[model samples]
Target: MKYKPHEQGFSILEMLVAMSITIGLTGTLFYFFKQSQDSFVVESARTEMNQNFRAALDLMARDIQAAGAGIPMFLGPIASKDGGGTNSNPSLNPPDAILLLYGNSSFSPVTVKAQSSYPAPTSTSSTIYTDIPTTAFAPGNYILYTPAQSLMQASNLTDYAEFSLFNLPSTSAIGTVSSGGTVIGNQLTPSTFSINPSDDNTYWNHTMSFPSSTSLRVVPLDEVIEYAIDTTSSELRRNRNKAGWVTVARNIFNMQVRYQIETYDDSTATYTASWIDQVNQAATNNRALIRSVEVTLFGRTQMSGSGDRQGQRAIAQTLEVAPRNLNLPGFAPNR
Candidate 1:
């Protein structure tokens, strides 16, 4: 076909304009895609962080609640004094005295042993064994006597006003036996022999000798479990059993512990609860009678950025739990 020929190619200016428009459209699409990707990353990191924080807190709370729970053999009575001692009174002398109500330390001198001298007495009076040899005593051993008879005696036959016996050796040294019968030793003597209602220091100390004395002195048994954040590495660490701290989570920003002390008032016949910042220091002495605990954890995203395309997230959680040591009578609200 015979037809007039049109300009075959576009001008240089037309080509340049077309190229610029194509490039602008491609750039806009790429920018939007980048922004969407950043937003997804931030949201995902935030959700994961929140989950981790909650999981940590929940685990802590469950363990705390199980503390000192079940197995009455390990824990003493729930009440401290039971209408026997005043707040000002020394906890060592409670009205109702019981021996080894709470399990002693693994190294405790007191222990329960099989009775070689059997035909176990049916009556309380028949069970009394006077003039018993101290060498025969085992840890956790007990003899039932009318509260009046000599409850305990020293190996040397020295009269102890009131004494408790344990299979464990005395922490203090007063004197030792060489070859002869008796040598002077650093024996802990007590003015009164009775069980302290409180688990405080009044029951545990080097001042009172067990097995040789009847009066109970409060012993200090403090256990610490802490979770801290490391600023340099941005990690979370836990220290339980007080051996040393070890990192548990990287990217954790903060961790905190809160305690609750539950107490009963005999006169009012009611219970009271209070929050404690810490339980081991002198400043928190009153609060140190903690029966429950609450833990809070905070974590952050590992990355940094801005806007939907590049921002990070923070997550936090709180949990509550009860400690085994603080479940004793005077410290527990329900007990």
Candidate 2:
């Protein structure tokens, strides 16, 4: 047969080379696209973890600052456990639990009513009545403040009466506010009421009265706030008083707290603060010595990534917060 240029076709070797070049270009493009997608996903996961860590820390900081608010110095303000407090046999990586005490100043104002036949505070009895339902008092220590009845005219020593709601006639739950605001049965105190007339310098006797009748302000000393991390669930939880635990943040891997103790150097005439773990300070009976707290929270991504790409990455945040009420004069002992 006679071969013509127009009828010519490529040999097998030439066709093979052309196919190889096309495959190489396609493979390179695919590789680049996959890498870009993976990077985007990893970045998104880290952003989510970082947001969760910040939220958890902000919630904790606000509550810590409220310690000892509206309550007398006699009551212990801050306490903490190195390991889990509620969990008896804690896990290998158990997070710390911190206890904070502050008055529920946010609660509705309740007034002492003479119409209910509420008697004046006496050395023998310290019972008082409020116009609101007994449920208004979250069964714990409370202060009866009669601002008009100060110990001295020009002094800051006002007549602040301290009493336990459990000591009242009928208080069922020790630290819960039930429906209808009424105290039903008498339950023993779970937390201590340390402010007594003999010991508490702020305690005094006064026959408080109002315009037409007599009234006194009922301020709660019962709010017990606690924060803990659930390692198993990777969540941060909080409980108020004797209430159930509420989740503050999810995908939280770890939580740690350190307390700051203020020490005054007599020779230097200066105050120096030291940060110590909860275990070391356990021997000291001074919760008031805790001037501030440092909190560290570690969070992890929920999603899992493939080989060489960790779907989960950890992010951490640290914050320091001072309890304003505790730093006030006469709040801390030996100050």
Candidate 3:
């Protein structure tokens, strides 16, 4: 027989020791991996929250800067509706509401082209003849009409009427393509417009009647914009032209608004500007004196925090904006 070498193998104690060491290493690695994943999740949530907050803030600020632009001072370009959560904490309740009014540059006074009321006031037919160009106005659009007489007499907006344009007679005022059915051209003709009727009680029709070629003040309905935070959804909403509430930002808790009024004292040659809130008595008396607006926003984090990070779960910020178009002394002709 050949000389046999003794078989050298691991002893049971040695094997047990090696296996224990391997298991401990694996357990440590797994624990480290779990911790890293948790950290990543938390950080990702925070990053997303910050991004949303920045975007929402930028949009609101931009709009606030542009508020009251091309709008009349008598129209109350900026109006605030207070959401009464102050008896309790505002953060525990809903946010305040604000309305900003601006103007459409394209809006103008249009003369009724029809000699007689083409569609009778009582007639449900959606039709009106105007001196607007055929291509200037499009079907499926909306027109906010304010009767000239009503606007002169009324203190409120009860006389305003908003109508959706129906099928308007198309004209090839511009060169039309051979393939395309009709490329309407622009012409200041007596264009016929059959607009969608709203209700029975529009003051323009119910109250006053206009002569042929009478001028009607046509306005863009969306000039009035409303911003509010919904308590149920915890989302910031924007509603324009009563088109319905559109969610603009999420994870928002509360919003408070205040106006800074500037009262110039000629005696002292100084201006005293005081910030007034809805609850203050001076708000109503000095609404027209508003020179700037102060907004407070409270935001909530997506992730819940523990002991060390508890305060990070909620954040509050204040933004003060001075609109360029308001509280200024200027004469705007034919605005």
Candidate 4:
């Protein structure tokens, strides 16, 4: 072969070295490109998580502040379940759930025209005949109906009217509404009215009789909100007005709730404030003592990997909300 630079092909050693340099350069470029793509995806997922988490918390905070608005003090405003998730067996230490009740003050209490209490609170005799028309009551709306027998509670001194919550009488429960908007003479059928035992207080298991119109009160509650985590899908759920649960945010791994209350310390001869995990079986009137609510939500991105690349990394945010309508003992906010 010619040795002239223009005519001669490169020697074997030189050709080998040049090929090695080109391969090394190409491999390095590809590696950097792959790294850049992975970083972008991870960051994008985290940003999405932040948005979802913020939206979920905002909705919950608003409801927490409105917990007791337009509700009677005697009616417990807030209730919580320690383990709200599907595996939420209390012993399992699952996520938590919270329920809040409130009403629209505009909805005045309807006096009962007549009521029945037979076959127990389980049957149709549980129907409540109100002086007002059934027009105001709708599906999912609640009425606090007082029976003649269970009207007094030692815990409640002001109003001797003890009431049980029912979820019907919307005219759909039985006969249709009349021209006057009232279902005169007609009553709801059996299985129409379902009692919510956990409303303000527990209802007596025994059947009780209805009281006279003058003695009975029909209080209306417009709001019943519950927040929980759907463990199976790892999402946050919200249920409103006895409606079915709906997803609030995705990839929300866990939720926790705590009740903040003021308790009187007999030993210290003073008042103390604390946050408790469970409110159902507390020594004192925990529900009534609740001055505020504390929520902890855990959110994570939607990627899956190990170590630094793990999409399971969770970001936790905490919020404390106090309802203006909640009554506090011993201490009052300045007007």
Candidate 5:
């Protein structure tokens, strides 16, 4: 069919304009789509990190609460001395004589103290029965004597006992000098003998004494529980005593631990929460005790490009754990 030259298909300029508009629209849509994808990736990564952090914290809290369970009492004995020492008595080479009592099912009101026979070792293999004054030894000194051995073992005695300063009571009873007895340079020694005159009469020559006792009573609580990150491989690993430290989440960047301690006032009947280290110091000085713990975790997205990614996502959380022995006198829970 005949057609005019003006009625031809699209001219070069028209085609160019059309292509330009199509490209512009496509570019705009592509930009928006890319942004949406990035946002989704970031959010997903953040969510995963949060879940991982929670799982880790929960695992830690559970284990910490279970610490010293079924374990020997002396294994978790409170520190009585500031220096290093084994938990065995010097004379008996046996385990320390600290007694542990769980006051409640929650294991929170626990008590640890030295047994009456703990500080002395008998000479004979048979059980020795002697009412030795608690004043014979220095207060807070780690005493490890066996009931089978006499407290006054001869100098010839070898392997007489094993003793560590850890987990001994902060205070001890000592013989008083007012009743013709003397405390010789913080050492309680018998100077004279006294008799009970009445049925209700007990020896009036004993006094409570306090000496340097530095020992750890509770195990320290871990903040992270478990967390790991590999920037080179873009992998994250975390575990909380589950199935042999299995990985719970990936692509983590960092993990941190913060602690909270509750300080109690006997006069006011009030409690205050403070940081872990601060509480630790106070507890060590017999000022306050640790009551709770908190944990925080941070993570990042996996790398998809060779160069560094300008965008990053963070996940954080906090957990609170109440420690055992919170209300006990002179006892501080470690977290």
Candidate 6:
């Protein structure tokens, strides 16, 4: 078969042009794929950050709701004492420390059996023997509420006395009652109510005292929860019952809290609300007036991947919670 030069399959120039077009299309596809992958990584990181923040907020909210659940009636529930320096990071900014005290929500209530002791330590006039053995009581802080007279038989509404238990000698000494006429004792010392009428007294007096056979309720000191931010580590941590702090969320940049104070106007028959920081509350000495809290949390994503995929992202979350235990009716202070 005789064929002319014009009838050849493909010239070098034409082949070169086709190859160049193919290479250009392949490069374009690779660029778009890389972009999609980078976008996916960033979006995934953002989602993870959001989820982590939400989980942390839920835990904090639950603890806040139960703050001061079984605290002694005379003691303030929320304490804004600044945990200025932590064991982990001392140079960190004085992040505000919040202490929530509640009773052993798990322990069952034990009853008082005898007024005086039975044998080993012998019964003292101030002893309150319980039906359970001394070993049954867990050695810790406790709240004791006793009524001078039963509700049905009480002529005065203020006949009940609430005592804060302190310096319990041991699990065996649970029956022993503090001195000073059943009033708030030394709190740090162990003693019985003084027989002298002139002694600084609380619930118990010469007339009104915890009577024998009276039903009493006792709850342990607290759960003692604290939330703090470690600026150095960029993390949010929680402290439980002075058991040390544990990290909750990583890459947390900040945690802020604001307290809400509520006041009731009798004449106007209305309630008023105000927001204040811990510093202002300290100046006013109205910590008891705090009714609710607003929390703002900030977090960020860790740098991940390489080159185009390597970058950090940030997120912020906020929430408001009311602690029913702290804002108990007829007990909380005015705003």
Question: Could you list the CA RMSD of all candidates, in the order they appear?
Answer: 14.5, 11.7, 11.5, 7.8, 18.4, 11.5
lDDT of 4: 0.60
lDDT of 1 by residue, 195-261 (tens): 3223232543322222332212221122223344555676666554335667666676655555565
lDDT of 5: 0.34
Q: What lDDT tens digits, residue by residue, belong to model 4 across residues 1-335?
A: 86756757899999999999999999999988977877787888889999998999999999988775654433346777775443443324578878776765666555544334211233224655555443465555554533222222122222222234555545576443244764443333323233232442323222221222234545557777878888899999997775578999999978888887655655666656777786642335346557678898887889855644544656888888987665454333211
Q: CA lDDT of 178 in candidate 5?
A: 25
- What tens digits encode model 3's per-residue C-alpha lDDT throughout 1-335? 89988969999999999999999999999978977876776777767767767777777787777775543332234656566565556566556767665655555434433345332111223344444442255422233233333122212222211122222334432122122565322222223232111212231132112222233333333355667887787787787655678887788878888877655554575656566664221322233456688887777777764633433456667788877665353333234
What TM-score goes with each of the models? Answer: 0.49, 0.61, 0.55, 0.68, 0.44, 0.60
Which ten residues in a row are the worst by lDDT in model 5?
95-104
> What C-alpha lDDT values do all the predictions have?
0.40, 0.56, 0.52, 0.60, 0.34, 0.55
User: Arrange candidates by TM-score, highest first: which order?
Assistant: 4, 2, 6, 3, 1, 5
Tens-digit lDDT string for candidate 2 (24-68): 999989878877877778788888777777788888888887776
| Candidate 2 Cα lDDT to native | 0.56
Off by over 4 Å in 1: 1-5, 11-17, 66-224, 263-269, 280-288, 307-309, 328-335
Worst 10 residues of 1 by lDDT: 152-161
lDDT (tens digit, per residue) of candidate 5 on 1-335: 99667666998999999999999999999988977877777677667767766676676566445433322222121111111233332212211111111111222211122335322222112121223332233323222121112212111122111111122223333333222363322212212111111111021112101212312121111111223333344334433322123454565444334345344555576656556321112232221233344444445555342232635654555556553433333332332
Worst 10 residues of 2 by lDDT: 204-213
Q: List the residue pairs that clash in candidate 4.
A: 84-95
Q: Look at candidate 6 and give me any clashing residue pairs.
A: 117-123, 178-192, 179-191, 179-192, 179-193, 180-193, 180-194, 181-193
User: Once model 5 is optimally superposed onto the true structure by TM-score, how far is the C-alpha of residue 180 displaced, in angstroms?
Assistant: 34
